[model samples]
Target: MILTLLDRLNRRRAWLRWGLLAAGLLVAFGLPWTLYPPVATDIVCWGLFAVAFDLLLGHAGLLSFGHAAFWGTSAYGTGLIAIHSGVPFYVAVLGGTAAAAMLALPIGYLAVRRSGIYFAMITLAFAQMVYFVTNQWRDVTGGENGLQGIPRTLPGFDLSNSFVFYYAALPVVLLGLLAAWRIVHSPFGRVLAAARENPARVRALGYPADHYKLVIFVISAFLAGLAGGLYAVNHGFASLQEVYWTTSGKVAMMTILGGIGTLWGSLVGAAAIVRLEDWLATAGFEATGLVTGVIFIAVVLIFRRGIWGTITHLLRARAVAPVPQIEPHLEHDHDELQPTPTN
Candidate 1:
């Protein structure tokens, strides 16, 4: 009977997962109609970035304060390739992502040797160094002026139109999300989760926990680079702002606010943040930082586990909630054998 009840709950969970996925896709399809094209595209980029960051921080139990290094590197790499090679923008995006992964390999190798704040500091230090180099390399990177005139062409097709570009990017974003989901649900992902919960136990079981951390760090960089490349393509420029420390901070904040390890929560957090920022800007709010901080605090306080996290927690609780304990009198069935007691 207990086994039967568990099976029913599992099936219910599967259906709920599919239903949520369908609902998300439906809402995403209608987003552009409700918001500006460029704004919609920004949301998609940030959403992908958040998911990538969460994979490493939330799942692998690594906190990085220099993710913007990968993001900026990809932006620069993508722009340079598009400017010179004149290839399809997606090709340039891939090239840029490769560059980010290569950079991550050495950095992650060193950083993964440490944990907690040490790990974060190591990544941050390397990222700052990269930022300095990029800033000084004015001719190649365009430095303060930024890398401009990057084309958004797809052979004979023009993606110069913001509306058209949003549609083009939407599918790619969905594919990235799907890939992240698969990564989380696979055997490898199970190992990652175990490692996160108890690295010592995972190591004792003969798993190379350190190697996994390095690998996921690189993987996270690759995915983040994809987001950065697309962002550059959308704007037709790569700027210093991409490599700034605050860029990393913002993504980190969004991931935490959404719920540390929940991948879809990143999307919810990203949407909340991006929309809030956009609204603040449009309303002529000069003190954007203060207002955004207040909003973030408000959301965090209200949705303790994060907006999506709290919602899912409730749903998960409801799905497998414990059966109520019945009083001894009610425990007896109409036809069940019961001991006769003398009053």
Candidate 2:
């Protein structure tokens, strides 16, 4: 009976999962019509960026403060390719993403050797180095002004239209989300999670924990790069701010506000933060950061699990919670059958 109950519960959870995914996709598809296409595009780009950060911080227990290095690098790489080489949109994006991954390779190798705050600091230092390089290479990077006049020319599609661009970006963002989902659900992801929980144990069990960390770090950087590449095309510019430390901080906030380990929650957080900032700007509030800070504080204090995380917790508790138990009676029933002693 217990096994039967468990099976039914599992099936119900599966249905719920599919239903939620369908609803989410529906909202995503319909959002451009409801809101400005440009705004929606920003949400998608930032959402992907946040999700990439979460893969390292949430699942792998690695907190990186230099994620913007990957993001900005890819943005510049894509923008430059689009401007100078005149490559196809897809090729430019791929080249940018590949560059980010390559940059991550050596950095991740060194960063993974350390853990905790040391790891984060190492990444941040490297990111600062990258920032300095980009800032000084004025001839190539456009320095403070940034790369401009980037053409959004996807093959066979007129991407100058905001509506058309939004649709074009949608599939790429969805694929990034899908890739994240697959990573978290796969056996490698399980091992990664195990490593996160207890690296010493994972190491003792013949697994190289550092190797796993480095691999995941590279993958996360690649996704961030992909988002950055898309953003460059979407905005027709790649700015130094994209690689700045503040951008990394903003993505960290998005990941935390959305619910750390919940991948989709990153999107929710991104939407909340992006819309909040836009609303604040529209309202002529110069102290936008103060209001955003207050909201972050409230979320951290009131909903410790974050917006979507709290909702998920409630749903799970309601769905599979056990019934209340009764206390055992002290006295035995006289009519109950007793077994005879064996010879």
Candidate 3:
């Protein structure tokens, strides 16, 4: 009976998850109509970027301070391809994503050898190298001015229209999010989580934790690249700002704010950060970063589990809470209780 009850509970949980996912997707699909197309696009792009980062920091237990390298590289790659070649947008995006993954291969190999802060510093150093190269290569990258006038031509779609472009981009972003979700729930994802909890134990089991880390790093970079490419196409521009260290920091903040390891939390975090920035900009708030920092501190202090994490924690707590026991005397007649005492 216990096993059957547990099985039924698991099935209910699975259904609930699927229902939530479908509802969320529906909301995402309808967002462009309700919100500005540009704003909606930003949410999707940044959300995907945050999810990618979470895959590394939340799942793999690796903090990389240089993800902007992949993000920026893919943006540039996609922009160059779109501007110089007659290829479709999807092809350019794929090419850019592949380029980022390739770049991650050697970087991850080296960075995986280190752990903790050392790993972060190594990644940051490499990212700085990438930034310097892009900045100095003025002829190719257009230097500070960056690349502009990138073509938005996609077959059978009017990408020139913001609404159309947003719809076009939404599916791709959803796929990326779904992929990340699958990664987090899969056997490999379980191994990655295990590696995060105890690298030595994973290594002792002959899993080669470093290899897992490297693979996850590459995968995360590829996803970041995909987001960047989509962003570039959406904006019709690619610039050094995308690859800057600040960009990396912003995405990191998103992951943290969204409750880290929870994949959907990344989207919530992205939306929160992006909307807050937009509102601040419109309100002529020059101290936006200061305000954002204060909010981050508050979140860390008051809700250490983060927004989504806190919500999930509360739900779980309620689910497992013990029921209050009633006194037997209250349920039985007073006379019956007296007779029982006599017996």
The model with the greatest TM-score is 2
For model 1, name the residue pairs that clash: none
lDDT scores in order: 0.90, 0.91, 0.89
Q: For model 2, how does the per-residue alpha-carbon lDDT over 1-343 read when each residue is reduced to its tens digit? A: 6678888889999999899999999989997998778888989999999999999999999999999999999999999999998877778888989999999999999999998899999999999998999999999999999999888876777889988889988998999999999999999999999999889889999999999999999999999999999999889999999989988988999999999999899999999998889888888999988998899989989999888899999998889759534456736744456664422
Poorest stretch of ten by lDDT in candidate 1: 334-343
Which candidate has the top score in lDDT?
2
User: Model 3: residues >4 Å from true position, as ranges?
Assistant: 321-343
TM-score of each: 0.92, 0.93, 0.91
Better of 2 and 3 by lDDT: 2
How well does model 2 score by local distance difference test? 0.91
Each prediction's RMSD to truth: 7.0, 6.8, 8.4
- Order of the predicted models by lDDT, top scorer first: 2, 1, 3
Model 2 residue 44 distance off true place after TM-score fit, in angstroms = 0.8
Q: Give the per-residue lDDT of model 1 (tens digit) for 153-260.
A: 798777889988888888878888888889989888999999999899899999999999998999899989999999999999999999989889889878878888
